[model samples]
Target: MKLLTLNFLTCAIKACKSSPASFPLHPRDVELEIVESDINLPFLKNILPRLMWAELRTIAAELGLPELPETAPTRDHLVEGKEEAKEGEEVDEVPSQTARDLHRVLLETTVKEGKLVCGNCAHEYKVMEGVPNFLLPGHLV
Candidate 1:
């Protein structure tokens, strides 16, 4: 699963819904892979508001990736040189270093194999072949 997708996932157990800990399910014994693709700056800008920055930082730290900034970056920080645009002529917006780093972490990083453990329930959700199995057994459901 892409780290981007993991940002939106929560614990599958119905009982864990009310817990703050359920979101940002922690990775354990992970086998990570980098699946590179073209970065979409617009998509990054659009999704900035929805990211759980602290949780993402924690996940990155857990996976032994580089540390994130103390605060979440604003959408404006994702692109460079808006001021350079002329009155009528459109200027190309270049992705900033911040944007590139964000793209690397969120889009390129993949969990090839791992267990996502819920902080609330301590339930382990297996991830295999870059796909997370979120389905719960009948009792968990």
Candidate 2:
């Protein structure tokens, strides 16, 4: 799955629900794939408000991906006063860099194989072929 989807996932253990420590399940031994796709600025902007910035940053860093900003840009920052253009540069380009970064990190990148382990419960959820297996064993359900 995209790193974006992993942001909202948590340990599947029923007793672990609603615990902050269980969330942002840590990706371990990840295999990454980057496949180019059309960039959708509007979709990136829409999801910015819902992302957990700090967790994303940490995970991305752990996986050796390009660094995202320590905090997500405010909506104002996304559409604010334009960037200063050099003689040959686009005036609005700098401001959209954040969106571009988000698009790359959250959309273009995928985890082809890995395990997402809960920090609190130490439960592991396997990811295969870019799909995370969040199913709990019958006993744990």
Candidate 3:
């Protein structure tokens, strides 16, 4: 999973600076898109070297989601990082993952108000007061 960081205060400041109606739960300054895929080792191999796990974990925890596992998941494998368990508590590999799984996790699990993260670029979109801040100001890391 591409780790992204959205500084709540920075996001809020940017949002409010652009518009007075911006708020934490109703953010109106960002937009996000989650990409689902089937690529395994190759995909992760390509991006893993570019991310900062610390940044990624911060985003996940802020959203009240479980953290990814400590050991790196082997390619083509789905290790339920951390989320609500189903009746079976098990699902297909392709359907459950971070780096190789789809990015719709956030969109599908909640209302249209919260933080959004890109699974590829690791970009973080802050959604407050029903708005998402997709703006990247400097140092496109």
Candidate 4:
């Protein structure tokens, strides 16, 4: 699954659904693959506001990807001239290395195989062939 998707996932066990640690399940024994695609700067800028930036940065580091800054690009950072004020270049006009890294981590990288374990309940979910099986057994469900 794309790293972005992990941000939305939580442990499937009903008891752990409300637990904070259940969200952003920690990846274990992960196998990563990069499938390149054209970087869409506008899309990146659009989704920036929605991501859990800190959690994403932590997961990226856990997966052996380059670290994302603690702070993500603000909407103003994507504005025509605002980026120059902070980064000395308009990010909308010329995507920065940070933007590129975000694109790569969120879009290009996929987990080919792994298990994501709930930090709270320790429930394990298997990922195979780029698909995460969040389904729990009948008793758990």
Candidate 5:
């Protein structure tokens, strides 16, 4: 699954819902892959506010990826500048380096195989073939 997906995922156990530690499930023995795609600048801008920056940084560090910035980048930072457009014409915005880096980390990076462990419950969620299995047994449910 894409790192972008992990940003919204938390521990599946119902009991762990109230715990802050349940978020940003820790990756273990991960096999990572990079699947390149065109960056949607608008999507990145829209998702910026929803990201748990600190948790994302922790996940990246745990996965041995490069350290993220101390603070999250603002939507304005994602664009370099707008191209001059004629009257009544649409202007194009150029994506900045910050946008590119964000795209690389959130969209390109994938977890091919791994275990996402909950910090609160210590439950392990299996990820196989780039798909995460979050279904819990009756006890966990």
Candidate 6:
């Protein structure tokens, strides 16, 4: 699989396994926190086979964040694959994601420093220097 996809899956799984108190993180000017605790099955059905709904819900509950409700809100409100509206020199696209989009999302998308975990694959990714420290041990290999 592609590195990004593998990484995202592994991290998501780790988040689901670790204790919330031990979540690793990178603090920014505005701070970073997982917002949703509840999971809306209707909203999640279309994401992909890789997303573990059970894991996601478990992680959210652990973090004390609530997930979205089953109903209400517009369709695709919580879906990924949405692209940036602009395409100019000021903002460049990086593969599937734009540089600005990636930057904004990446900063908000770090595992907690000491207690980081993934909700999908249950793989752990440490956070160091305000960045995710994703190093895989040889056991899985």
Please state every model's RMSD to the true fold in angstroms: 2.6, 4.2, 11.8, 3.2, 3.6, 12.4
Candidate numbers sorted by TM-score from highest down: 1, 5, 4, 2, 3, 6
lDDT of 3 at 123: 46
Model 1 Cα shift for residue 37 (angstroms): 0.5
lDDT of each: 0.89, 0.79, 0.42, 0.82, 0.90, 0.36
- The total number of steric clashes, by the backbone 3 Å criterion, in model 6 comes to 32
Query: In model 3, where do residues sit more than 4 Å from their true spots?
Result: 1-35, 71-112, 115-131, 134-141
Q: Comparing candidate 1 with candidate 5, which one achieves the higher TM-score?
A: 1
Worst 10 contiguous positions by lDDT, candidate 2: 76-85
Give the winner by TM-score.
1
The alpha-carbon root-mean-square deviation between model 1 and the true structure, to one decimal in Å, is 2.6
Determine the backbone clash count of candidate 5: 0
lDDT of 2 by residue, 1-141 (tens): 888887878888877887888878899998999978887766666777788899999889988988877778765455424434345544442336676677788888888999999988998889999889987777555
Off by over 4 Å in 4: 76-82, 85-92, 139-141
Q: How many clashes in each candidate?
A: 0, 1, 15, 0, 0, 32
Candidate 6 per-residue lDDT, tens place, 36-134, comes to 333433423333344433444444344444452333322223334323333442322122222222222322333334435443444555555445555
What is the Cα-based TM-score of model 5?
0.87
TM-score of each: 0.88, 0.82, 0.35, 0.86, 0.87, 0.32
Candidate 5: worst-modelled 10 consecutive residues by lDDT: 82-91
For model 5, the stretches where C-alpha displacement exceeds 4 angstroms are 81-92, 139-141
> By TM-score, how accurate is candidate 4?
0.86
Clashing pairs for model 2 are: 1-130
> Candidate 6: worst 10 consecutive residues by lDDT?
22-31
Cα misplacement distance, residue 105 of candidate 1 (Å): 0.9
Candidate 6 yields a Cα-based lDDT of: 0.36
The order by descending lDDT is 5, 1, 4, 2, 3, 6
Give the C-alpha miss distance for residue 112 in model 4, angstroms: 0.4
